[model samples]
Target: MVLFAAGALLLGAGTTSRIFALTPENREAQATGPLTAYLEGQGENGAIWLKLRNGEVLKGRFEVKVGGSFGAYGKSRGIDRPGAAYEGSGRAIQGGSPAFVDMKGPSGATVHCEVVNDDANAHGSGVCLFSNGAEYWVLY
Candidate 1:
């Protein structure tokens, strides 16, 4: 009886560990980005216009239809740089709440934004982790 009980306990512990183990799918799902979060909460039809830290303006329009997506177009005219067109796409990740966004911009730049506070309106804030080893505080 003692051996049987010990075996049962070991089996239970192993099962518990397996249940809580972080699988690849779970890891991907939990790794939501800020842009994804922002676009997800945009509802069926929503829009945002925000100013970047570099004084460039970004205007995004989100459409939840057609598999939930967002597109943005903007221009940056820095001190010496001529105005250049900037465009990007934000796609929502499946089964991600508060939304995880995968965003890709011009010149192959990408970032992930997770929407922490989504009022589902014209204003929101999130943290963006860029592909170029940079992070920024985003407000829209």
Candidate 2:
């Protein structure tokens, strides 16, 4: 039985997957569907603030470039960093057309990201806020 349990853990199934959640409650949140979010804006170290359907929010630093390959930022595994990180990698599903997706995070933080074009750096000058309570800003 122990061997079977360990094998299950190796496969990253529902059982072991929960062990890796950012928080205990965050683990359960993973069961929810993939988070829906947008690109918001390009930030230093690729950080982005996602505005979600719910009133909650998600802020993280990433390494995504405008013309670089796409990364699956919405995954639970991508939240290892404190404020910002480059946690996901994949093809650009939305290309340069800009897209929004339902994003999920630790502690049931549901959020979204809307793409904005900002080429500034330092003193958090590379972000733009919207009336919808969403803002895309740089981490550094």
Candidate 3:
């Protein structure tokens, strides 16, 4: 089973992944550069907390749709079914679905992410773009 419910992904799930800067300047300095940010999720949906070098923490949510079906997680992604499997949050997401994440930072900043998910194991990899002309590689 998969979980894509929405409310608060930063509530604490102890699951976190490191995101590296994909920028040219940051790329050359990545080995000794800043941590860039962090990415995490529960099921097909989760939140991104961007911890940039400027000591900024931007928060955002991620949603996924399988075969272009279903809607946002917070709206109608959590389809309640009886005798279903259990994984992550309490939502079921079809495997091989495309994921899109939208998160807003302070001062009109935003972070957008695109990920390819393997719902069976609740793990995925993708890329995230920050409004400040920064890009990051995401995995969790």
Best by lDDT: 3
Which pairs of residues clash in candidate 3, taking residues 3 or more apart in a chain or in different chains? 2-91, 3-91
- Over 1-140, each residue of candidate 1 has an lDDT whose tens digit, in order, gives 00000001112212211000111122332343222222212233333232333333343333222322222211111111121111112322222113233445444555444332222222333334455555444433
Clashes of 1: 11
User: CA shift at 116, candidate 1, in angstroms?
Assistant: 2.3
Best candidate, TM-score-wise?
A: 3
RMSD of each: 20.4, 16.2, 10.6
- lDDT winner, 1 or 2: 1
- Give the poorly placed runs of model 1, Cα more than 4 Å off: 1-97, 120-122
Q: Estimate the lDDT of model 2.
A: 0.26
TM-score of 1: 0.31
* lDDT by residue (tens digit), candidate 2, 1-140: 00000111112223221000111123333333223222222222333344433545655433323443222432232222222231123212222211122344455553332221122211111122223333332111
Error of 1 at 66 (Å): 18
Q: Could you give the candidate ranking by lDDT, starting with the highest? A: 3, 1, 2
TM-score ranking, high to low: 3, 1, 2
TM-score of each: 0.31, 0.23, 0.52
Candidate 3, TM-score vs. the true structure?
0.52
